[model samples]
Target chain A: MRGTMLYAPFDIRFQELPDPVILEPTDAIIRTVATCVCGSDLWSYRGITPFTEPHPMGHEYVGVVEEIGADVTGIQPGQFVIGSFATSDNTCPNCRNGAQSRCIHGNFMSTCQATSIRIPLADGTLVPTPDQPSPGLIPSLLTLSDVMGTGWYAAVAAQVVRGGTAVVVGDGAVGLCGVLAARELGASRIIAMSRHEARQKLALEFGATDIVSERGDDGVEAVRELTKGIGADSVLECVGTAESMKQAVRCTRAGGSLGYVGVPHGVELNGEQLFRALIGVRGGPAPVRRFLPDLITRVLEGRINPGKVFDMTLPLDQVAEAYAAMDQRRAIKVLLQP
Target chain B: MRGTMLYAPFDIRFQELPDPVILEPTDAIIRTVATCVCGSDLWSYRGITPFTEPHPMGHEYVGVVEEIGADVTGIQPGQFVIGSFATSDNTCPNCRNGAQSRCIHGNFMSTCQATSIRIPLADGTLVPTPDQPSPGLIPSLLTLSDVMGTGWYAAVAAQVVRGGTAVVVGDGAVGLCGVLAARELGASRIIAMSRHEARQKLALEFGATDIVSERGDDGVEAVRELTKGIGADSVLECVGTAESMKQAVRCTRAGGSLGYVGVPHGVELNGEQLFRALIGVRGGPAPVRRFLPDLITRVLEGRINPGKVFDMTLPLDQVAEAYAAMDQRRAIKVLLQP
Candidate 1:
């Protein structure tokens, strides 16, 4: 199997690797149908996150089951499926509570941007599509594995109440999807904080009612002004930088909730500030599996087009180009067809 | 008028002070019906929190309106009312959203442990009782000013679902009130963390189904064991210390919510830990005004007895003793007749 590996910062390569096979009764091997580069991937690609040794790349994928373990149930070979970035038994107390990402036996889906891979806890982690999706739907189905679900989780965590205003910080793929999720959740007004034209356009298409082309305190002021000085009722923080977090917290109205899914980087929340803000804070890794069924239903029903986030798509051999495009901000996301 | 003043750590005195008079058109002067020592008061009284000047010592009180400013409309002279420890306009964005403590025009109700105190934003901050209550109801009504309401806020913030399990840290008066609040909110099983015999007894009486005397890691393990290793569905963090906060977070199941009403002291949360735990954290100064009306009705109907927390009482002139009793933990709470 040809897999993507990050040997060092900016040193991504496609190399031959052994094909994955079921190692446990709960595992299944799947042939990758689609995969993509994530914003967080850039953290390592840009050397911001230390990459000590060669590491397998990609955790998000839409795949077709190639073989199933003896104990696996509900999923079978030849079925198109969506699996979360992390594998979970889905029956643990945490998984049952809709926090599969924190599952006791959870493991990251490593080396997944390849032709084939083994998924542990197949029965609990994989959700099959109604049928083999068309190529057009593959890109969107791939997103359901992580980005889309993350945005949905963000909206839910933020308590984006129906008929309320929702502000999404960060114009990355996740943030764009948040606008869509906020809209799907019935936020009457969606505010996207973006300075980039392409991302801003995508955000508007994804249901952003307003776009504030500013950052930091200025951005907070812009959001406050939009909501008549009260700030948004719900805020989705897609960027985990300290500044973005501060902006997210500041732009939320008193008692409003903020869902942060960007994975905090150097973010330190002052207790006094949070106490005074009285904001309800809830977010972490997206429990993508929890929202899969509903989101899959929505996608199949033609209610949303989350796949629009994939601005570029390349053949499996062009994995390096996919990484470069996203690395240089040339693409919001790059879908890889394997 | 006479009020309790903290001259220094462990140095409390009943000092003569000028009688409060309306200083704003929205102000009302209330003659103290009942006042009590709060757990937070010990922060300064024990010198854990610095006491620089001779500060007026009380904030919690239930009283009768003795005089009102021209603009005060909802409250009238001679009306028994429940006023939050902090005054708020209640019409501001924050107050309208149920965070009256963060109201744009909010102000702490200082110098309240006196014969009379002035309350600003009277119409918005005061909730009149159905009628003048019996002397027995005064203590419970006094709790509405802070502690009881704070506990109620904690439960609400934790989103205690009907028939869910609730774990409360900190067995002080507020935590005891949280047990009562959890029961009122329909939690089927309430766990109270307490080592003190008196606090444990009060907790059981207030509807705690279990008590865990262990603190820190052991306490978390105890809660986990009680919940069949899943942890509590809702946890109330009533103590602001770092250890208490950590225990509260650790004892909560993934996806469970925690409401921390204790003003955080020496508490710093690592984003990674919280993110991995995937617990929802929300709290601050309780928006007591929001819950005032409901709590008042419950107290008036003989449905609850939050006043039972007051195990001792002292005359206004014995203010020093009132502070001493609470400071020494000799009394769960001490009510003052002013």
Candidate 2:
């Protein structure tokens, strides 16, 4: 099997690797149907998130089951399926609470960039589509494995409600999906913060009702101006930097909620500031498995087109180019055919 | 008029001060019916929160309207009322959103220990009782001004629901009140973390089904054990120190909620930890005004008895002793009468 690995900063390699097989009774091997690079992948590739040694990359994929462990009964070979970036048994206390990302028996999927991958907790992790999806729906269905699911969790965590106003603070693929999620959740007004023309256009298409290009304090002022000085009822912090988190907090009105899905990299929140603002904050790795079923339905039914976030697509063998394009800001996201 | 002044650390003095008079059209001067020493007052009293000059002390009070400015319409002179420690216009965006403590036209009351207090936004800040209460009910009604209301807010913020499990992290007056609040909200298992025998007894009386005398890591472990190793569904953080906040977070289950009502001092939260835990946190000064009406009804009907938290009583002139008792931990809370 072939797979992508991160050798060093700015270094990605597409090389032959050992084939995956069922290692446990609850494991299954899947032949990758489609896979993609993620914004988080850039964290290690840029040396921002240091790594001591090279490792397999990618956590998003749509695949067809190739083999199943003896104990896996809910799914079978030849079935098309999707799973969360984080694998969960789905019956643990945390999973039952809708926090599958924190499931005691769960681990994040990191080798999905390979042509074939082994999935643990197979019966609990993967959800099969109604049927083998057509090629046109593959990209959108692939998103359900991570980005789209994360965006849905963000809107849910922010408590976005019908007639409420929403502010999305990042313009990346996940942020764009968040705009769609907020709209689907019935947020009456959606504000997309971005300075990029192309992303802004996509945000508008995803249901953003307003756009504020300014950053920092100026950006907060713009949101306030648009909200009658009340700020937004719900703000999604998709960028995990200290600046973005602070801006998101300031953009939320008192008694409003903030849902942050960005993996933090030195974000320290002041207890005093949050207290004074009376903002409810909930964030973390999204429990993607919790939303996978509904999101898959949404995509197959053509209610959403999150695949539009994939501005570029390439053969799986050109995985290096996909990473480079996204790193250089030449592509919002790249869908790779396996 | 006479008032309590904190000239410096450990120097609370009851002395003559200028009488408060209405300075705004929406202001009302109230003669002190009752006021009390708060745990927070000790922050400045202990020099932990410094003051540049001697200032009138106290923010909790149940008073009778003595005079009203020309524009004050809803409240009348001689009416007995209870206002939040933080006054709000109630009509402001934040107040309308149920966060009156962050009202656009709001200010924290600081001179309520004096004979008279000029309450800004009188019509919005003060809630009149159904009628003048008997002396026996005064203490319970007085708690609606701060401590009890704060406890109610903590439970409310933590999203306490029927059959949910709740953990109270402090055993102070507010924490004891939180036990009651959790019970009122229908939590099936209410755990109060405290080592103080007196406080534990009071907590049990307030409907705490369990008491964990341990602190720090052991305390979290105990809560986990009580909660089937999943931690409590809702945690009330009544102590503002970093340690207490951290303990509260650790005691909450993944996807559970925490409401911290403590006025934080030097507390900084690592975003990464909170994110990983998926613990939703919301805290601030309690918007007591928002709960005043319901709490008043509870007290009037004898459904709650939060005033029991005030174990000691003192004449207004003995304000210095009241502070000493609370500071020495000799009294859970002290009620002062004018």
Residue B194 in candidate 2, Cα distance off native in Å: 0.6
lDDT by residue for model 2 (A1-338), tens: 99999999998999999999789999999999999999999999999999999999999998999999999999999999999999999999999989999999999999999899999999989999878999999999999999999999899989899999999999999999999999999999999999999999999999999999999999999999999999999999998999999999999999899999988888988789999988899999999999998998899999999999999999998999999999999999999998
Q: How many clashing pairs per prediction, in order?
A: 0, 0
Classified by CAPRI criteria, candidate 2 counts as high
lDDT of 2 by residue, B1-338 (tens): 99999999999999899888889999999999999999999999999998899988999999899999998889899899999999999998889889999999999999888787889999999998868899999999889999999999999999999999999999999999999999999999999999999999999999999999999999999999999999999999998999999999999999999999988987887789989989899999998999998999999999999999999999999999999999999999999999
True contacts kept of each: 0.70, 0.92
What candidate 1 gets wrong by more than 4 Å, as runs, is none
Candidate 2's C-alpha runs over 4 A off are: none
TM-score, candidate 1, chain B alone: 0.98
Per-residue alpha-carbon lDDT of model 1 for B1-338, expressed as tens digits?
88888888999888888888889999999898888888888898889998578889789988889999998888889999889998899999889888899889998876888888889899999999878899988989999999999999999999998999999999888999999999999999999999999999999999999999999888888999999898999999999988888899898898899999888998776666677777788888999999999999999999999999999998988988888787778998999897
Clashing pairs in 2: none
Q: Report chain B TM per candidate.
A: 0.98, 0.99
lDDT of the structure predicted as candidate 1: 0.90
lDDT string for model 1 (A45-77, tens) is 999988689999999998989999999988989
**Maximum-lDDT candidate:** 2
